[model samples]
Target: MSVKRLDWPDWLLSTLWLVVIAFIWWMAVRLLHIPEYILPSPEQIVERVSSSPTYFGAATAATLRVIAVGFMAGVAIAIPAGFAFARIQLLEKSLYPFVVFLQTMPLIAVTPVLIIWFGYGLVPTAILVGFSVLFPVLVNTVAAVKNISPRLYFVTSSMGANALQTFRYVDWPMALPYFLSSFRISLALATTTAVVGEFIAANAGLGYLALRGVRNKDPVQVISVVLIAALIGVLLNAASVLVETKVLRKYRD
Candidate 1:
């Protein structure tokens, strides 16, 4: 007789993989007699973080503030701007190049100017994060609107629907999915840009903590910060997916 196979939960599988990696890491360090300064084992990184939870907690909270503000502001601006660009050909022609130019400009390059203008604080950091988030959602929104079948517009017009009503009934619902599809990318960008911003200007953030780790030549400290940043990104991405599912259900219903 053949044996049956079991399917495992995704989280369990993921945890198992992490455990395997950590075991290999611990074994390698022990076998090779690696120095903590070069590449600390996972246990050392955990110990480092545990030794100073408050310090890392504060830095995480600070970075999160920038991310939350930036993500919200970026989404707030991108949706409206996307509609405007899609609805107005002249405006798109005139201003989109500028948007592209700004998008092309590296965050590191812009952070210094932002520091000069806003002077090393939350505002500049949030703005930088928002800038990073804007493009993907905006582009998706424009594509979503433009991709609508012309026949739907015809039907709405034939029913004597106003532009606003057509948009409410047709455009918003149809485009929302496309707009939200960008959320995952935008959130990831928000996290990364926040770190980069903190690296350049902020007094306290995970990036700042990592910078300190670099200064002190502490691998454990740096690895702990990196792990925390990665964990934050994963959580944010998962949250965005849940939100997208709930919102799409409401809109479609």
Candidate 2:
């Protein structure tokens, strides 16, 4: 295939945007004469990250673990629950309201209750992350599955396909794109909730590091931790997008 050249690829444009933003940030700090402790220069944040790579890396790893577990747990439970909601009208009618309520509940207010119930630790944090991501996945999956054309189901039934076969051959492929989209959103939410979880209670992770930085009057550390969190969110979102593109490429046409 022959391709026409473009001004820039998306990745290049993204990088350029970051650079432009950084330049503006640097200019703001310099022009405004903002103190380092209040708003550390980009250079200072980088210096802080570089100076203590081991520390930040450890913290990031800890938080990453929480995110991973929570993501998996959320998907594991939500997908099945979604299927149930779609397959059983009574179940959906009976249970969906509470599920929606859970989704709408404010996490900040719920955090202390979770702490009291689950206690201060990784488990509560993981649960928080899982809870935070669950509703999106559930809602998306049910909607996707339920939104399929009735003709597809009739065709599968005419072919004498069993429930499992129908799901594999009809529902799975049709629903995957929506599922992946929701999955990406859930993952981003999971990362943020994981940080919030750590902030509420935890010995390690970026949130804890940020808290420590605050207590110790270390803006560089706080900003460095924020930088790491932002990087993780970006990378995760990118990975999700790549996976969706690869998996959904055939569906595009």
Candidate 3:
């Protein structure tokens, strides 16, 4: 018997949810009489964001470039390394501990070293983001590969599929969902890493803008930068979700 697919009107639901959030924000700003410095209203944030579109746009573009390059590089290295470790018991045994150690190492602790090593430009930011985002991809990919059913492997072997064929057809298909999930997580982590790198050492970007706001004691601008950063992160995550939905639709039934 064929399974009935559940049709979710995701777009409509998302729109409705956004509308509700906007309404709530509007009510809060209008009813609370909050100061702009302490808590800038939505209107204030929008105005600030709009005032210097060029500068904000350039900073956003810079941050996004770092995030994209770093996240792709991290995933590119991680997926292959994860597959190797999954198939090779000795390699898994040797590397798994180190991977765990790396995961536990705080990004804050190593930010200085990264800046020193890669310098105060895009390279350091990209490397920092990559380092921060790599663990999820690596761990999830390994788990996905290792968890493929032994029965399926045996059946494929009996059907004369070689190691390469088995990997292409069996392992990869099973791992695709997990990989996408990891990618979703890595995307967000990469963005945060980029911001952190910028915060530590940068001449421009949202984090630098935030630092300036702090030094100048402009709470409105501080909050504005934060909101913009959050919006950028949400947009990035939404894009990843769209990609995952399209790519993994086959597995969702």
TM-score for each candidate, following the candidate numbering:
0.93, 0.93, 0.87
Query: For residues 1-106, what per-residue lDDT tens digits would candidate 1 score against the true structure?
Result: 9999999986688789989998999999999999988889888888878898999999999999999999999999998999999989999999999999989988
Return the candidate ranking by lDDT, descending. Answer: 1, 2, 3
Q: What are the per-model C-alpha RMSD values against the true structure?
A: 1.8, 2.7, 4.1
Measured by lDDT, the strongest candidate is: 1
Cα lDDT, all candidates: 0.91, 0.90, 0.83
CA deviation > 4 Å runs, candidate 3: 1-9, 250-253
Pairs with backbone N, CA or C atoms under 3 Å apart (clashes), candidate 2 = none
Q: List runs of model 1 lying over 4 Å from the truth.
A: 1-5
Q: Can you list the residue pairs that collide in candidate 3? A: none
lDDT of 2 by residue, 143-243 (tens): 99899999999999999999999989898999898789998899889999999789886778999999999999999888888888988998999999999
Looking at model 1, residue 59 earns an lDDT score of: 98
TM-score, candidate 3, is 0.87
lDDT minimum window of 10 residues, candidate 3: 34-43
